[model samples]
Target chain A: MIRSGGLRLDGVTVLLADGSKFTRKLVAQMLAEFGVGTILEAEDGETALDALKRGPVDLLICDTLVENPDGITLTRMIRHDNGATYRSIPVLLLAGHTRQADVIRMRDCGASLILAKPVAPKALYDRLAWIARDPRPFVDSAIYAGPDRRHNVGEPPNGVARRQMDRERFADQTKSSVSHDEIMAILRQADSL
Target chain B: MRKSRFAALATRDGGRKRSDAVQAAESQLATMEGDYIAEADRLIAQLNVLSGAAQPDVEAIYRVAATLRGLGGAFGYVLVSDIAGSLCDLAERLGAAGQVDPPALLAHAQSLSLLHHRRVKGTGGDGEAQLCEGLARLVARWPAATLP
Candidate 1:
């Protein structure tokens, strides 16, 4: 967690879990320019765990293929820890691939954000700025503030029917919850073919 | 037993299965090699701009050299890895001392630059090859973590 100080800019401590010395240095330099005072480096997961034990870290920036304990497993450990200090810290996972499966896996591992590696300095700075802002509560309305507003529609005046009709027009909405007997009958019909 | 069952499954393999396994290994190796070449080329280009005495960022130089040393061999560029390792060692020594002889460092940087140029042109000499070999030998003596 970041300690509150008199400085207008927040004091951020970053833990970098990357095997690439070049990338670590570049990130350290960039964060320094962004007013981050404390930057910890770990070339592998084992060292990263050691660093975590040394002090309270505000943010963790980890590479996907860290030596020994990989980034996903590290994130799981952080998320599952009973300690308040460890659980509250945000994790940002970095990887070379932008594959959707990789992003999904990182998210499932409790990563707050996923960044593709070879990141530009400006983009990195922007992400840091976002992380510096006060984190929203998990159950906050902000989580569902997306384009999928139809899910929120309720009965009558809320236009639930209209939304349901629109959804049904595009695809079968009730097929997933059909009764087991109905599904069996359908399977039987298919078997006859 | 489970072990006996597993042995029975293993016995089902044929020549086609063996060839498929070999092909998979070859493909994986090729993909890793391609990724290595791309990353090395990018790092080499970045090194060209930063390798000079006038620059005061010792940590950055050490970091780049260290990464090259760690990754070059994995990517099949042992020569580049070896030279980078030597540079990292010198950079670390300079960093610890908090001061460096700029002229000497610049000369070393020049040599590295020349090697990079020769590698690019595919005309590296026996001396360059020997320098790379010497660097590799030096790197073998240092720990991976402290070098970067």
Candidate 2:
């Protein structure tokens, strides 16, 4: 891990799995600006796995097309790995243009969050905030072994479908900025998880 | 104390520095615009040379277009990104169908070239609109992920 000054996500070590050197440097710069230090870079899945062997990582920001195991398979490996820290650390998967099949596969593999390419820093921050605030319970089955896909924690167990609520919230949030309290509440809740 | 410091950093960032950071990122992305288009051209040429009888290198084309799409958008070239995205998506779909149409591939490839040229000229108005319309027509013919 490349350590630096005291900052948010400074204590939180990160592993970035991307094949492009330019992209990896640019992403590292962005994360640095976000107060993240100690970012470990990996050009492929093999490198990432090797890094995991050394110590724990707080988050994994990876590209979908990373070589070797590929991003999906890499995430699956981490999910299935017997190491506790590897299985539980948050993963944010990035893609250029995601297909339905890709989404289904990512969901099945148990990725924490999925973001599209050309990710705005604020959008990336929001997702990271979500991960830190509410580290969702993991669901291990005959297959899946990542964060629980069920995200409707506040939803009353009424007859209303959770998908509809999610869609409505997504539409609403897209229009305006998430409130300060909303972000902080998420931050404060990080410990409870 | 570590947690509070983290929170303070996060909160303090919601100011001019944040927008400045975003602007700086955009500026950096602008510098790499040429490289993205250049790579797209090379990839499209590879796709164009393929005979309809022989299989197009789907994985290779996908990698190029996907990189173009990501990098183009990262550097604030939405047109390049969107156009490359369409090509990438079509590549994936065609690869899935186990058939490659050279003519269709050429049109999409040329469109990226044309779009990049126009974008450099700062003529991203009606002319670009029409180019995208042409692209949309081709996209309509092919399978797209989020085709409207």
Candidate 3:
């Protein structure tokens, strides 16, 4: 997914959090091939947190089953770590096809993206592009904290149209009035880019 | 229309360079099959150990199946991953149920056994769909209520 604006990950530092030696080695090897500068491997969540505290990491490639604390727990802890230098690092969770309940849980736990495993470098690269381009602001709520889940419209395209009255009512209830400054700020950001 | 010979040569060289990179990356990945076999064999042995137990560790079985799910697709074994994926679903359901149905569990295990045992190609060759169809039936059998 090569886009207009360059999304070069050439010099970024990455952390690989997986328990299996083979999984960690393969992921690191692939990321190196992608031109990442520094790749660190952690076998558990505790090690991951320690690494984050010790260095400036741009991204986290985490496995769900990492022990001493799993990936979800690490994500939650990273999100909760206020004023810490490593709190804002983007986390990419590596997991299998998640059950519906776990999907919501992972989202709530602050995963920037979920890459379904057998990790294709092309898919991985596409995700990196998405993260670089899609500037989804963080959402802090009582129940969830991380990337905004509402970034996408929660409807499939070409689906049956809802009633006009229902649409109007829904829009009336959920719309937030934006300030002029807020709109201008967004416009300025786009212009600068 | 005249194409400059210099431009033509540059295009040829560029395409060759790009394809060469692709091939290098692919071959680098291809080198992991030995690792895959070793790790998979270890996991299968773990699964076999659990299967022999009067009451298998559902969480452990689920972990092995799930881990297999993650690894297969990365290494170009889509069919193997899909089979492992179905096994993961079954494992998760059985874990939630708090009781092991050994026969059903064994069925999923055997499906996985078929994957690694037979060395199904990563891109899904040699009866992969037929194999998956059999397991897909098993995956769909358990109702949604089985989820935790």
Candidate 4:
């Protein structure tokens, strides 16, 4: 029975990975304010992986440009190479630039959500809320393994559009506004097919 | 994926209001403004030093500029973010070619210095906007496809 006073994150353990110390501190502070119980800090991808292996992490908030394997690579590794528990956790990738190319890479790598850098509290809150209620299924395939990319909140076109007419028909429904139940139903039907 | 364990915990009843939580988080950012300014200053200085180097590390400049872009916008220094974003574009293009254009590096470094020195914030005036536009134009000269 979920009663809503606000978003309760007091029990969530977030792994905050970023190369820049300042960036990490800023985000960590926000997470603390949100009442996140345990916030783990990692400077790079390997350290982040180590943190994941050491114990349970509820969510992963990572920077796209974090050094070594980088955020995209790290997410890919989690989806493809890590254990089942590590593979399916929600991953929020923070990027400095949301350029088309960057968005493509982030999407292809299996991030649960992608946020632009200098993250605002409201945006962060909304994204976290969505993640909290996220109903997207874990997709395991040869080429891609993570949350079903076809169903995402802030997704970018990954060159998989269904030509001109289909796009025009659904142009009115913004991608981000798609409801969680709607996406789950769609994914369910997709799985059936 | 199944409902994340985070969801189960987060969606539990009893939590602070969203507005209150956001206000608290923003207040924390406000308190960090001074530190942000100091860090931005240090990064700008580092950029200037890199620009003066006989062979400026284009990758380093890109990384620094990327940092400035990320920081400045949060603190309402929109001009700093915009200019630094341009610098990142230029540096990335140049770095791919293994070329070091000191003048281009210095131009961005000087622009960042001017903004920081005058304490310009939030896109400044039309002049600042034009300056940013020019920098963006300089960046566009080297298209991503051309470099890649």
For every candidate structure, what is the RMSD over all alpha carbons to the true structure, in angstroms?
Answer: 26.9, 13.5, 18.4, 13.5
Poorest 10 consecutive residues by lDDT, candidate 1 chain B: B1-10
Q: Which residue runs does candidate 2 get wrong by more than 4 Å?
A: A1-7, A153-193, B1-55, B120-123, B143-148
Best candidate, DockQ-wise? Answer: 4
**B33: Cα error in model 4, Å:** 0.6
- Candidate 2 overall Cα lDDT vs. reference? 0.61
Alpha-carbon local distance difference test for all models = 0.50, 0.61, 0.64, 0.76
Question: lDDT tens string, model 1, A31-137?
Answer: 55444558899999989888888866767898875768878778767666655455546677776422223445565576655664444333454354344442343
TM-score for all predictions? 0.41, 0.72, 0.75, 0.84
DockQ of 2: 0.10
Which should have the higher DockQ, number 1 or number 4?
4
Q: In candidate 2, what are the lDDT values of residues A1-193, reduced to their tens digit?
A: 0112212454667899998776787677677666575789999989998897776677889998889988988998888987555776678888866665676777677677777776655556555655554435667777788777775644222212422332232232122122334323322332232
| TM-score, predicted candidate 3 vs. hidden true structure | 0.75
Query: Tens digit of lDDT per residue, candidate 1, span B43-123?
Result: 665555565436646566665665555554332334455566566665565665565434333333444454443342121
| lDDT, candidate 3, B1-148, per-residue tens | 2222211222221121223333455567778878988888887777767755788887787778777777765655555577667767767766665666555556556556655765655434334444455556655556543222
Q: How do these models rank on TM-score, best leading? A: 4, 3, 2, 1
lDDT digits (tens) for residues B59-116 of candidate 2: 6777777766776555445566777777777677777667665555556666566555
Q: How far off is residue B5 in model 2, in Å? A: 15
User: Candidate 4 on B21-104: residue-level lDDT in tens?
Assistant: 988998898899899899999999999999779988887888888878888767666667778888888887786566776766
Better of 2 and 4 by TM-score: 4
